[model samples]
Target: MGRRLLLGMLFLLSVKIMAQEKDSRLCLGLNYGFGSEFNNTDYTFINHFYKLQLYYKLSETKHFQYEILIQPEINFAKHQLLNFYFVKPETPDYQQKREDYTQLKEVREYVLNLGFLVRKPIGKSCSVYVLGSIGPMINDTETERMSKGFAFADVLALGFSFKMKKIHFDIRPEIRHVSNAGLSGKNGGYNTRNIEFGVSYSL
Candidate 1:
């Protein structure tokens, strides 16, 4: 009976040590990004964005890992002008009237998102992952004819990660979409494609 008790204690200790060796509990990351709008024809320059993320490892196996993450992001862009030119005829006469007006300027946007990440390990320290996120977004430029103050945002990303001791680095290419941009009467939404690089510290 004493021999069996000693063996059981030794087994529990080994299991505890194994759990500690495979720990990837929590992570914090920051990323920088550069991107451009996909459907905008008038924009001349690519935009700059930044993100801060917090991740919690929900579950893991020898080959796969799953995480839940929250990210807050912001984007900065150049101001743009929308011009409308109209030509009208007065009293059905030969004379014509022409008028032009400027509409709205594109500015900055802020987003807060919650997402899930699925990672598959390829080697000891290298992995590939995919992520999807959805949340709320706000833009600086909100007008009757343009995007609203609140909108729904969605993100999709594919990336690779390299783990080093307690630190991990990631490079991801992502696509983001905003629905009902500016609550504008025209209902023209927004879409962007970007690449992001991030460094994270694991706990």
Candidate 2:
């Protein structure tokens, strides 16, 4: 009876170790981003993002891993516009339009990104990944380039992740497009190139 109880305890310990190994697949990440180089004329956009990321494993391969990324974030932007081409020459409010488009504006956006990532391990502690994401955004201010209210942000990124113990550090460079998809008449949007840094902890 003593020997049987000892065996049962060892089996339970082994099961707990396996559960720990499997539970480490989930992670939480905090990311920050910076962007510049607007695509439209007379427009300067300074962009920043604070992201809370929840990572879920989608599937796995022998040499690659696939993950689902969901991010809820806040975007703060500073905008400067010095040109006015949206209004025509004969329009009644042409001068007023020009005046409105020539000032400094602060815009805030609420964003949610649903993403898919595929990664390949380079060695024991390093990996490379490609991520594609698109989601909705709520624009809190209006501009000559685009309307306020509803839009979408699409992103594509390539990055590397370095794991140190239970924490991961990531460096990513990405391109982004923010547009209304013809949902509004004033749908000329903003385009930017960005770089992001992140730190994550495994569950």
Candidate 3:
């Protein structure tokens, strides 16, 4: 009877240790990316994107060895223009009105997102993941020609994570879409594809 009791206690202790090793609570990350041009724009523009993220681990399943997380992120993009524009009114002598012209300049965009991440371990310390998010996005340029404030945003990403002692390194390719649906009629939607690299700390 004493031998049986000793074995039961040892089993419980080992389970506890395994649980502790698998526990992950929080993580912080930063990433940088280069994206394609904004769609539906009158002027030619290029983009460079950067991001910062925070993640909270919600649950883990040992049977499948997968974890679910909630992630909140902020993204910034710098838009460089290849041309300049200006609006000109119709001339008195001509019946037709003049169209707006294009100019070269830099514009910045900001976005805030909340999303879910599903991470599955591939090896002892490496994992592959996918995520989806929705948020609001705005741009420094308030003109109708550019994306206005309060645009609806959505994102999808696929990435791999390499875990160290207390840190995680990640590389992801992502796509972002901003829609003006039900928001504005003047501006259409835009989409971008980018590859990003990030480092995160586990807490």
Q: Scored by CA lDDT, what does every candidate get?
A: 0.74, 0.88, 0.64
Q: What are the runs in model 2 whose C-alpha is more than 4 Å off?
A: 1-18, 38-40, 90-92
The better candidate by lDDT, 1 or 2, is 2
Per-residue lDDT tens digits for candidate 2, residues 1-203, read 99999999999999999878666668899999999854656689889999998888778889999999999989999877756776567757778877876778899989999999999999889999999999999998888778899999999999999999889999999999899998976787888899999999887
Please, what are the lDDT tens digits per residue for candidate 3 over residues 159-181? 89899888889998888776656
For each candidate in turn, the TM-score is 0.73, 0.89, 0.68
Tens digits of lDDT, candidate 1, 1-203? 99999999999999888777545677898999888777544433357788898989898988889999999989786533332222224323213211211332456778898999999999889999999999887777743223547777788999999999989999999998767643554344556788999998875
Best candidate according to lDDT: 2
Ranking the candidates on TM-score from highest down gives 2, 1, 3
Candidate 1 residue-wise lDDT at 15: 89
List RMSD in Å for every model shown.
6.6, 2.4, 6.5
Question: lDDT order of candidates, best first?
Answer: 2, 1, 3
